[model samples]
Target: MENENWKNIRVPRVSSIEKCVAEFDITQLDVPSGRFRIRIYENTNGKFMGFTNLKIKNLFDGYPEGGVGNGNSITEALEDTIKNFMENLSENRILNDSDFIFVNYNEF
Candidate 1:
């Protein structure tokens, strides 16, 4: 949906991401009614080495609850943020930007 306020960008899906996203022990934070979950994955090698972060932002209030940190809601916010980051990285020839050194959550 291209518009005057913002341009549209497309991201080619990566099949290999399944393995990476699965490896991370997800750390999620959410306020009472707010809906958002951020997942960070660290790799020993590859482009997503240091810190591979994924965020799912909920656009509405209907986000379902799954366990303590699991939210059944599937929000596009999380996907949209990571997609933009990856696209820019690909353009800059940054095949290994996620390999940044370990640090606290605030640093990420």
Candidate 2:
């Protein structure tokens, strides 16, 4: 029998991430909410070279959760953060600007 998992496989894209530019903490405003760390980096090398490094970390336990993203600007980076975050977020969880507070925004 032929393998069927090939249809579910996804090719990984090349990354150009060089270094982190800014990182800070943020708190979710909803009930049962938690804190998270947002790190932005500069992508200066590869076919996908860019200006922002999209990464986020769970502050509660220091485990990597949200996937990743890349952008050319801060706004784009944050948008990508939210998008990837929501995709990785648990079911029934809601995320929004007003519901998420930037705890340490001085870094940005």
Candidate 3:
């Protein structure tokens, strides 16, 4: 069967803000004009590996033109996004279940 998109995955790591941060990245993402930005924070919970907190910024400018823009390459964007996702999963559960899943979004 064709794989489903990640946005529809409904990540269950939203329990703690820290987990959310780990599941997403900001620096790696393009970061549109007025979109959410990914954020990774180092928490001292010491529950798992000390470091805690992670987030991904949503960058999506009005898709007047299209989804493809001139900023970061697909490899770079995917790398950062997947990095955050992996770290979060490792800390908790569901490690890279959607890593291979390619997801694309645009601002409307």
Candidate 4:
């Protein structure tokens, strides 16, 4: 996959991402309790290097345990995070919602 040629994809700026949320399809994830929200963000830092970063947060707890995934595109970043989350689950390293990176929704 690494050898495959890639094309340029435009991503929303971090500062204006909230306004452009509709541009990207919102993905709903099934959790132990309920659904989770997957929000994609343009990695301003990765912009120079041509990569996007994603953050996954739990709906009930507003925790982003999945961490930031850097990739050539939004989809790649999201997939990486999901894979990591599943791996953690299989290892039983993740115990609860608190295991994720907590964030204040009001602050976003």
Candidate 5:
């Protein structure tokens, strides 16, 4: 079955954001004229691990854009997110909403 076929697929696992940043392709999938969403979550062990994750989403559908960024701080995380977002956009891995890019910050 098509569902079973997916189970047999072996995808490479990235243990850290550093690895993702190193392997990300710097290509723009489309014009950066559309809007997207940025969700930030503070890592509980962020200070200890020195990293955090950032999620980018499509405002229209509220679905993630498949681009996660790891950074040393909130600002750094955002920078990384944008960098990865651009690459994902070029690869057509992310969708454009052209509506608005919402920024949600949750206090932890």
Candidate 6:
């Protein structure tokens, strides 16, 4: 099967009060694989000024496939996202690459 076109994926808009700090597109190479979008947001709410939120969306469906992470820095959020994604994949028994597509993360 041909690789899904990640470029056509549309992400949700951030709230006017929050600012998007960074964004990335990662490709999943297994069953249910597709292009995923990672977005880091800086909260501007007075009570949450120093907090950040990281969200990972499955571009194929524009939904939270990897869940959300909260942290004080981007690195922490990314680590959290990785952990969540692994757990989600394992829970669904998508453990091998033999029946799906394969692509290096850096190739994007």
Best-fitting candidate, scored by lDDT: 2
lDDT of 4 by residue, 85-105 (tens): 555445533455444443344
Put down candidate 5 lDDT per residue, 31-103, tens digits, no spaces: 3333344444443344111112223455466664445566676566666766676664554454444422333
* C-alpha local distance difference test of each model: 0.30, 0.47, 0.30, 0.41, 0.43, 0.46
Error of 1 at 49 (Å): 24
Off by more than 4 A, model 6 = 1-16, 31-34, 45-65, 92-108
Q: What lDDT would candidate 1 get against the real structure?
A: 0.30
When sorted by TM-score, best at the front, the candidate numbers are: 6, 2, 4, 5, 1, 3
Model 6 Cα lDDT, one tens digit per residue, 32-52: 445555566555431111111
Query: Which TM-score value belongs to model 5?
Result: 0.39
TM-score of each: 0.25, 0.44, 0.22, 0.42, 0.39, 0.46
lDDT of 4 at 90: 55
lDDT of 1 by residue, 18-51 (tens): 1123223333232222222244332222222223
Candidate 1 deviant stretches above 4 angstroms: 1-74, 92-103
Candidate 6: lDDT of 61?
56
lDDT for 2 (candidate 5):
65
Q: How close is each model in CA RMSD to the real structure?
A: 18.7, 13.7, 18.0, 9.6, 14.7, 13.0
TM-score of 3: 0.22
What ranking emerges by lDDT with the best candidate at the front? Answer: 2, 6, 5, 4, 1, 3
lDDT of 3 by residue, 60-84 (tens): 4211111111113334433554454
Question: Over all chains combined, what TM-score does candidate 6 have?
Answer: 0.46
Q: List the residue pairs that clash in candidate 6.
A: none
Number of the candidate with higher TM-score, 2 or 5: 2
Measured by TM-score, how close is model 2 to the native structure? 0.44
Clashes of each: 5, 0, 13, 2, 3, 0
